[model samples]
Target: MLNVLSVLIGLFALLFMIPAFLPFLGIANWLLVPVALFGALIGMLSTRNSGRNFCLLVAAFGALRLFLGGGIF
Candidate 1:
């Protein structure tokens, strides 16, 4: 149940991530990281690692975007 919930939250963050990936939109990743991290937190409470890993991957993408774009694109 917690895994499912965590994935759902990750999915919510992913919706934002898609748009944030566009050029000139990298700044939005600042918001995406926290959301993905929150999902990762919930995922960590679950028994399975899939959700947690997925959320972390999502967060990594957000962080990478912020780093590459310098927080504003």
Candidate 2:
């Protein structure tokens, strides 16, 4: 269950982050709000082990985003 939740949140975060990569994309910052909220919600719903894994997923994504130069996935 927690792994599923982590996947969901990771997917959503990638979805939300992907738009930032577009050169013409506008308002990319807005997506972060819901992405973060959903991530937090997932975290809240997750157990300790799952929550830590989920956070790691988030961090991996953050690193990816950084590598992408702050662009969407």
Candidate 3:
């Protein structure tokens, strides 16, 4: 279940990239970072290493987007 959640969250993170190109989307893009982070946290607590790593990667991507775009901080 956690693995599935991680994959879903990763996919969502990928989708979050779309807003980067569409400026009209506004702050909606920033919301995905927390969701990705939540997934990473859940993955970290799970026994599946693959899911954990995948989620961590997603979290990294989300963080990169947020940092580069200056969405937060």
Candidate 4:
């Protein structure tokens, strides 16, 4: 249950992340990072690792975007 919830939340964040890749819209990821983290936290509770890994991957991508954008686009 928790894992499912985590994956769902991560997907939600990913949806929002689409625009965040825009040259000047990277700031949106500031909001997405926490959401991804929350999903990761929830995923950590599940016995399986798929959900946790997915969320973590999302978070990492967001972080990389932020880095490339210099923390604020």
Name the top lDDT candidate.
4
CA RMSD, predictions in order: 0.9, 4.8, 2.8, 0.6
Minimum summed lDDT over a 10-residue window in model 4 is located at 47-56
Q: Per TM-score, what order, best first?
A: 4, 1, 3, 2
* Worst ten in a row by lDDT for model 2: 24-33
Error of 4 at 61 (Å): 0.3
lDDT of 3 by residue, 1-73 (tens): 8877887786787677566545545355467667777777777777886766776776676666666657743
Candidate 4 TM-score, true structure as reference: 0.96
- What tens-digit string does per-residue lDDT give for candidate 2 at 1-73? 8647756776666676566545544245345545645665666666645654554566555555545554433
Where model 1 places Cα greater than 4 Å from the true spot, the runs are none
For model 1, how does the per-residue alpha-carbon lDDT over 1-73 read when each residue is reduced to its tens digit?
9999889888888888999988998888888899989989999999998888889999998898888888897
Residue-pair clashes per prediction, in order, are 0, 4, 0, 0
TM-score of each: 0.93, 0.46, 0.68, 0.96
lDDT of 2 at 4: 70
Winner by TM-score = 4
Model 2 residue runs over 4 Å out of place are 49-73
> What lDDT does the true structure give each of the candidates?
0.89, 0.57, 0.68, 0.94
